[model samples]
Target chain A: MALKFLVVDDSVTMRRIVMNSLKQIGHENFVEAADGRDALIKLNSDDSINFIITDWNMPDVSGLELVKQVRANPKTANLPVLMVTTRGMKEDIIEALNAKVNNYIVKPFTPQVLREKIEQIISTVNV
Target chain B: MELTNSMEKLFEKLGDLKSFFIYGQKLIPTLQKILNFMQDTVPLLESVNKSIAESTSKIPKATNQLHSVSNATELATTEILDLVDGISNELNSIFSKTSELKNRLQKQKELAEKLKSKYQNDNEIDEFLSYSLFDDELCFVDASSNKIQESIMNITIALQVQDITAQQLASVNHLINSIQEKLSGLLLDLNGKERESDKSSSQHESITFNENARYVKDNQSQKLADSLVAQTNGVKSQKEIDQLFSNKNE
Candidate 1:
């Protein structure tokens, strides 16, 4: 079954890049959100969305906060989240880890890196 | 004669006593007023001393807060710089990817041209002209290749993201400059140093920030040229753009 992925980012270009990468990986079903709040709406509305890829810096609701909300919610508690962001600092990484993101990938990531992170997250969750 | 001498001496002594009593009478009320004034001033002086002690106690805390503000602003500035760096790195990646896409499209277009030339038959052209339904597959391939070139052009236009990000970072850089100047003024004020208004008021003092602003300004013109070129379907390669930036830096 094809996974329904929610790709969240404020930049349209970044979203397209992520979605294109996902498409290249054979995951064509995507629900794109402009930010965390939008992601939540999509997540709530769409039951088939099984995975999330989000950027860290967003207005109103950040990716970290979105992950926290996902973890807190009973419906999406165990859903896998991969934080793809430019916030590569150690503290940011720790914060994302503490937020319970399944995996993290820094920005300017090659498609291969993204694929690895996605695979790693999906595998970890499956385990 | 002894009575006369004694009486004279007693009169002299009486005169001196009269002088002393008169002086005491004059000084007693003034002395009392002075003592009362001292009594009133003692508590006031004590209160003043207590207020001074309290203010002195808070000095360290105020200084610590100023230090914290400075540290916080510095941290914010560092984070913004990191964000800017990340954005630049991302733009570079996107440029490379777009360049690769352009090359692929060019290759496809070249192949399509080669196929078109090889398959072009004068008899078939007459037939294609006669029947609208007799569409040559090569013609479709040529059109699709042109579409690919258009898509590549669009990608090149999206490189305007760099310009937008640069402008945003420039604004952030301006804000950081303002914060640093304000912090500098605050510190100087706290330390009782002479706050040089000339230096603090000018927002162009930080060499690093100024250089960044200048880069953004230069990129603005580049961004304009890039947009116009992209519109004309004449996009520069990533290597050429990099060279242009490096030349500007030099």
Candidate 2:
């Protein structure tokens, strides 16, 4: 079974690159959002999206806010989230963990790291 | 008695005028000094106001140039990505075609083996074997395909630098705009203009960005971030455990 992904980032370039990486890792089903605000709207509308990969520091509602919203809602609380971002600071990563991101990825990541993170999340969620 | 009262009234009036004259004498020099100070300070104030205006005027242009750089990089990145995607697609086509041919070649070799076993006396079957799809040829195609795919992924990874650098630039832009706003306020104060009440003040919030965003060539930060996350998950890293024991022993 193919897992659907919601790939969220403000950059069009990052969005395409993430989707391209996902495709390389053999997961083709994707929904793209330009920011966290759009990601929430898409989540509310789409039921099949099981995985979310988001970038922090977006324009309006950020990825952290979106993750918090996901955790607050009983419907999507258990869904897996992987934060792919350039914010690699210790405090930033800790803040994200407190926000309940399942795993974190710093950007400029190789395809292998990406695949490993995604698979790690899927496996952990499965367990 | 009436004459004495009139005399006292005249003296009183004269004394009041003498005091008034003395007060005027004292005030005249002070007033002149104030005028002199104003004459001396006017040009200095004017120069400051002019300096502020000049500085503030150039800021918008600097910001606009930064904006231009961001836009130019974004455009270039998009074009490069388009080409990279094309190349990736070509690699995909090559990979699929090679895999399909390999499968077909395997079927041919299997059929050839069956015929050889059926015809034991046919030694010519060995000579008739198809050497077209050699192992080395397929291996070369697979290896090259892997190498090209890796290169495409690396290009994609490198393009992430654009986004990182753009964020850093944005942080700078935000700072410059803030400085510009502060200077504009200072200019208004210096010019003695009433700050036009900003009707839209703080009513709508604009985007806030990470001020400390920066680009690093290598993502060594990830390893540290991962350890932090692991710790938060109640998983102790080996280094942390060792440090804890060493501290306890000490």
Candidate 3:
């Protein structure tokens, strides 16, 4: 089955690399956004999107805020969000977990690590 | 009374002499002790003063050399500090330039990779075309052999027609030669008038054929050139159109 994914990042290069990596792992059904706000707009319009991969720091509406908004909404409350970011601080991890992110992946990671994390999230959420 | 006064003067003179001898004996010991103490202490005081003067005389010269050394040290320390500052500034400049060079190298790498991918794609397309156009041995052989056979067939047919026409023309030439030989004297007089009329008529026909062929060939060549130009232009324009479409899609 194909999974619909939403990838959001402020850097064009980062977004392309992530998208390419996902494609490499046989995940071709995805859309992109430049920031959390754009992600939100896309989410509001599209209900079939089930997975989100986002960078933590962005221009408007940070990833944490987006996660909070998703968890608050009834329609998207159960959507799985995985943060792929450079912020490896312990405080950032705890904050993301508290906001109910399904999983987290740090930046500069190999595609294999990303695939492993995605698999973990799908398995856990599917059950 | 005169005899008693002479006896008293003699006794007074004897007492005065005994007092003078006792005073002289005490003055001799006191003078000898003062002379002995002076001779013993004078050399010791002179030696002490000479030693103090020698030490005092060297102090100013030693102080002047110390002052010169201190000044040299201070100047050397200032120069060293300036050198250190210059090195630090140079290091900072080198670090900044290194950072900029790193960024430029990264950009160049990205562009090179993009160009490499494009070239690879173009090579792949060329390979595909080559494979499709010339892959089968039978097809390659047939194409060349078929052109050779067609040219041979055209030449053979043309030669056959020319041989038949030459044979018929040979018979007509023999009949005309026989007639010329049979009526040579009478025909020579009529040949002059016929030759003039034939020349005029043949010239008219040749002029008409030349004009017609020239007009037809020129028109055909012009049309052919126009079509070739249009075909090439279409091929060139198609690439530009494709580029525009791809850009729009991106």
Candidate 4:
């Protein structure tokens, strides 16, 4: 099976752009959710989702909260999650790091940067 | 002598009290003026409150309109993105067809040259042999093809602005709703009612927004993000470090 990505964001435009960007970089398998709560539902239903690309500042549950839940559950504890967000401050980055995202990419990222980070994470992980 | 002194002192105090009563009578008009001033401001205060209530009522409408704008732009952006994707696919197909055309032209030229050698004086073979249908056409298309693909990619990249603007509008919406909630609370208080608990008028008001979101045309923020990710990805994360210390204590 191909690597299925669970992309979580509140904005429909963001989800489309992210999925499109992923397709541009040769990763076509994608599952999208509009918010963190919806992301958890998708994660629960699809055990095939190997990687997670999430955005922070979502409604209901935040990206940080979602990552914490993913980590807390042993079933998805070790899955590699990357945060793509508009938060560029050092403290926000540190907070995300503490939440244990494999890597971080700021918003308005080029496909090249996404490819670079995805390749980096794929190298270190089983996926 | 003591008795006379006490009587004189008492008389002096009585005179002072009589003078005070005279001044007190004079102060009544001034006191009435202040009372009249208070009565005059009662209507002005109500007018100010009415204005605040009216403005506060408009906030929800403003936020709704903002949401409408965000949705409209996102719809337009999605349509543009779909068109770009379709054009990119068509461009790829054009490139492959041009490559095939180039190959077919090469073979035709070779065949015509071979026939010319057999029939050196044949006019048709000579005409076919010298015919270069696309001498510089393929080369020019190939060069411009890259530029076109690049332009298409740029269009896709710039579409990120819609998402960025949506986030910005969301941030603004959150701000507006929060103000609305506060103004509602203030209005409630100004109407001489007991202050109620913190109940937000809009459910979205409670959701936090990313205030720092913006459309940065440059990659400077990404560079900083890259450096931070680099710094953190190398080592055990802060959570891991915390876990390690906790485990050691155990």
Question: Per-residue CA lDDT of candidate 2, range B91-151, in tens?
Answer: 9899899989989888888887888899977877676665644778899989989998888
Give the poorly placed runs of model 2, Cα more than 4 Å off. Answer: B1-45, B111-133, B197-208, B234-250
Predicted candidate 1 versus true structure: per-residue lDDT over B12-120, tens digit per residue: 9999999999999999999999999999999987676565545544544443444445445445544544454455455546556655665665666666556657777
Write one digit per residue (lDDT tens) for candidate 3, span B51-156.
4444434433443443445335445534543454355455446556655655665666566556657787667555544443332543455565456534433332
DockQ leaderboard ranking: 4, 2, 1, 3
Q: Give all TM-scores, in the order shown.
A: 0.41, 0.78, 0.34, 0.85
Clashes by residue pair, model 1: none
TM-score of the second chain, cand. 1: 0.40
> Local distance difference test, per candidate?
0.61, 0.82, 0.56, 0.83
Q: Provide the TM-score of chain A alone for each candidate, in the order shown.
A: 0.96, 0.97, 0.96, 0.98
**Candidate 4's DockQ:** 0.56
Q: Which stretches of candidate 4 lie over 4 Å from their true place?
A: B1-6, B22-33, B109-130, B133-135, B195-200, B206-208, B237-250
Q: Candidate 3: give the clashing pairs.
A: none
lDDT of 1 at B92: 49
- Chain B alone, TM-score of each model? 0.40, 0.67, 0.31, 0.81
Q: Which candidate has the top score in DockQ? A: 4
Instruction: Give me the displacement of residue B63 in model 2, in angstroms.
Output: 1.5
lDDT of the structure predicted as candidate 1:
0.61
